[model samples]
Target: MRKLARWHIWLGWLAAVPLLIWLGSGLFMAARPIEEVRGEALRRAAVPMPLSGLVLPREPVVATKLALVDQRGRPTWIVTDADGATGRYSARDGLPLGPVGAAEARELVAAAWNGTAALSALRRFPRDAPPGDLRQSRPSWQATFADGAHLYIDADSGAVLAVRTRWWRAYDLAWGLHIMDLQTREDSSNAFLWLFGTLALAMALLGAALLFRRRRTATGRRA
Candidate 1:
């Protein structure tokens, strides 16, 4: 029993801070509505555009899939090749549309943004260099709005990829801490998490044992 107390005390000192952090972060995450945390209101609803009066590209490319959608109020073809390359072309003339430039990216985000914040800045990320927050390997334009929400636009298709709000980034940071993934913040199966989780469980079990032991001692004394 004495050895158990010593072990519990030592483990308590080691795991207390982490446990509190876990609890606090978890509660902070759970307290808010998931939709708000995800910034669903900031996204513009996608309207389905009919594929009528279309002209396909005759560039002798093997395409795995195709989508005809309205981009900037004009019918466009988004072609997906067998090699996983995606390109946007004009459905009006079947000519390949150029990749989204900085001006077009800013205009796209501003027009599509449902939020009232004014679009502030747009930065282009080339295909060879992708932003860390995007988590996808493709050319993109990151647009910053006045509300501190970042909207990502596909550089090729001029499509809205994602809208990450301030709250969303905060939650992401907390998730990294909770999962114990300091490096990439994507790996939940890290060794550090497993080690600390095991220690926490052991500490809990020892504390339970001590509680039962104290209760049994009290009952014996009364008898």
Candidate 2:
């Protein structure tokens, strides 16, 4: 009984670490609105898309997806063909434009940023390492505002990929610790979390046994 109680106490402490991470992260997520964490509130008001003046290619583009997105402050259509070729067309005359540069990237960030913070950092990632949201759109630009908001823009097409804030970063870190995926901060369905969960359950069962054993001993002494 003594050995079992000692093992239970030690295991409980060990299990508490992961449990606390899960609880703490869950609490933070529940307390904060998800929209704010995603930085949706910091985005600029959407511009009305122009439809009548659109001039598609005379040749069949055979596009898989067509998205009307904001480039700098202008509206543009990004077309992805069936063969995975992407091109940006002007909204007014459908003229193709060159790839996004530093100036256009900064303008895109400024357009999306509704906060009072100025530009703190603006860097480009040339298909090397991307943030969680920009994984699909590699070679992007990350513009960080002084208010702890980050905006990611596609370097190729000048599209705003995603917006992230400091709260999102904290939530991501907590989620990684809770799920035990420190590498990519994804994959919540791994076996490592299951192993720890099983051990924690065993510790709880042993703790219950110890409590019952102590209660019986006290009753016998009173008798």
Candidate 3:
């Protein structure tokens, strides 16, 4: 009985350090805000761009096309989709500025050609509009640009209403690291987390069983 108890205690102690380290790190990360981490990663990944001459557009323009225009309206970096169904992103900053849908595509064309209501609204609205004005009732995704800019596009409407950057680069970087794993799909990456969790549970169960066996043997000896 004594030998069994001793073994269980030693084994439990042996597992304790790694378990604590893993748990503590996880809890600390969870408690921290996501935005801070994401911002940090963005800062690290950011690349500088030249202020002069014609800017070149980035590849994979199928997702989004980006063009840099000067005050005179001459395009320095003209990024547009050949199919015209997708959006365009600036090669310099990777900031998506245009999206294409039936209505959205028309809006983009009008904004580019006629300088209509949509363009007027976009220009009039504060670049960093108040949170209350931008709040929506639906789920949406936001992306940070390489030039420390942010673009919030409505998922349902596909309208980009606001674009600006905040100083929380570290938070954003941390979030990106936490959510992005090497796996192609997010679910597969999550499986690794579950695997570690299961290991911890099995270790706990084995420890409990050893303690129970020790108690039983001691009781039998006394009886």
Question: Candidates 1 and 3: which is better by lDDT?
Answer: 1
Error of 2 at 170 (Å): 1.4
Q: Candidate 2, which segments miss by more than 4 Å at Cα?
A: 1-7, 58-60, 81-85, 131-137, 205-223
* TM-score of every prediction relative to native: 0.90, 0.81, 0.32
Regions of candidate 3 where Cα sits further than 4 Å from its true position: 1-22, 29-149, 152-185, 188-195, 221-223
Candidate 2: residue pairs that collide: 127-139
- Candidate 1 clashing pairs, residues 3+ apart or interchain: none
Q: Which whole-number lDDT from 0 to 100 does residue 206 have in model 1?
A: 99
When summed lDDT is taken over every stretch of 10 residues in candidate 3, the lowest stretch is: 114-123
Off by over 4 Å in 1: 63-65, 81-84
**Ordered list by lDDT, greatest first:** 1, 2, 3
* lDDT at position 187, candidate 3: 45
Candidate 2 lDDT, tens digit per residue, 1-223? 9899889989988898888877887887677888988888887877777576667644356789988876665668788888655778777677777888888777778877787888999988876577664545467899988887888877877777788889888877777887888777778888888988988999999989999999999999999
Identify the leading candidate in terms of TM-score.
1
Tens-digit lDDT string for candidate 1 (1-223) = 9999999998888888779878988987887788998788988876676666778875666778888767777777888887767888888889889988877777788667899888888899987888767767788999888998888999988877788888888888788888888668899899988888888898999999999999999999999
